[model samples]
Target: MPDIKCSVTECEYNSDVKCGAPMIQVDHNNVPKSNNSDQTKCDTFRAKG
Candidate 1:
């Protein structure tokens, strides 16, 4: 675990501004690095209703 911090309150795995998921996948468009937060997405994100 990399101690991922998250603030997506609507995600089922988000709790107290932290990620409670067993594992998280950060997806990028085959880029070596992302210059902004919008360039990536949390593949582990699951909608909370």
Candidate 2:
């Protein structure tokens, strides 16, 4: 299988190799609600370290 690169720079899972999981689950509601509905962020994000 091809490697998955994590987009989050703080996540230890993020590496030049691949993401630890085949897929990551993210909740949109977890993101802080903002006036700019177009904006998005992952509240569940955690550094692998």
What's the lDDT for all of these models? 0.87, 0.57
Task: Show the lowest summed lDDT stretch of 10 residues, model 2.
Answer: 35-44
lDDT of 2 at 47: 73
lDDT of 2 by residue, 20-48 (tens): 65456554554466555345454446677
- Give the candidate number with the greatest TM-score: 1
TM-score of each: 0.75, 0.38
Worst 10 residues of 1 by lDDT: 29-38
Clashes of each: 0, 0
Query: Which residue runs of candidate 1 sit more than 4 Å off their true CA positions?
Result: 29-33
Q: Number of clashing pairs, model 2? A: 0
